[model samples]
Target: MRLFNTNTARAGVAVIRAGSLDRSDELDVPVHAWVKRKQPWLVLPKDAEMFEDASTMEVLFKLFAR
Candidate 1:
């Protein structure tokens, strides 16, 4: 999955379980590191609204709407 910070125009990719949205440290480290480095004010692995892979357009709409 892809995560984007609209405020900073920065984005990262991560692998999360579809059912639980759990992230794997080994796979997500790079994304975590980038977030820590570039957007330290933000906390990771926080509770967030989850969408299915098919809801990508909805995600994009919501993101841009904000």
Candidate 2:
């Protein structure tokens, strides 16, 4: 079971953020992937690397970037 915080719960009030839709177009596929690849550094807990970080958002961006 994935645990989420109050912010996460509040943020998901709808399928998307109420005013965030335009951000997607600002992302070039390359930049998007790069940002995603590096994102895990922000979200993963320091001691949570039990297995591959492959499924982490950071890895996804890295894969998408290349």
Candidate 3:
């Protein structure tokens, strides 16, 4: 299995820290649904702008609506 080193892991953490929402923030499912594409799990900004880091589960749920 591929392993993530500290630097990469920390980078992911930085993304979350830069996000606009908190753990308790309720996300709008339909809005997220609009962004989920067949080829990609979720759509990003025009440039695939970095979002404040979210958990894998959080990101997946938003994309898949599970």
Best by lDDT: 1
CA deviation > 4 Å runs, candidate 2: 1-54
lDDT for every model? 0.40, 0.37, 0.38
Candidate 1 lDDT tens digits, 1-66? 443223323244233443354553344321222232445575566444433223354454555576
- Which parts of model 1 have CA positions greater than 4 angstroms off? 1-43, 50-55
Judging by lDDT, tell me the better candidate of 1 and 3: 1
Question: In model 3, where do residues sit more than 4 Å from their true spots?
Answer: 1-55
Candidate 3 TM-score over all chains jointly: 0.19
lDDT of 2: 0.37
**Model 2 lDDT per residue over 1-66, tens place:** 322223352343222322355565464332221233464545443443323322344543454578
- Candidate 1 C-alpha error for residue 24, in Å: 21
Candidate 1: residue 37 lDDT (0-100): 41
Q: Compute the lDDT of residue 58 as modeled in candidate 1.
A: 45
- Could you tell me the TM-score of candidate 1? 0.24
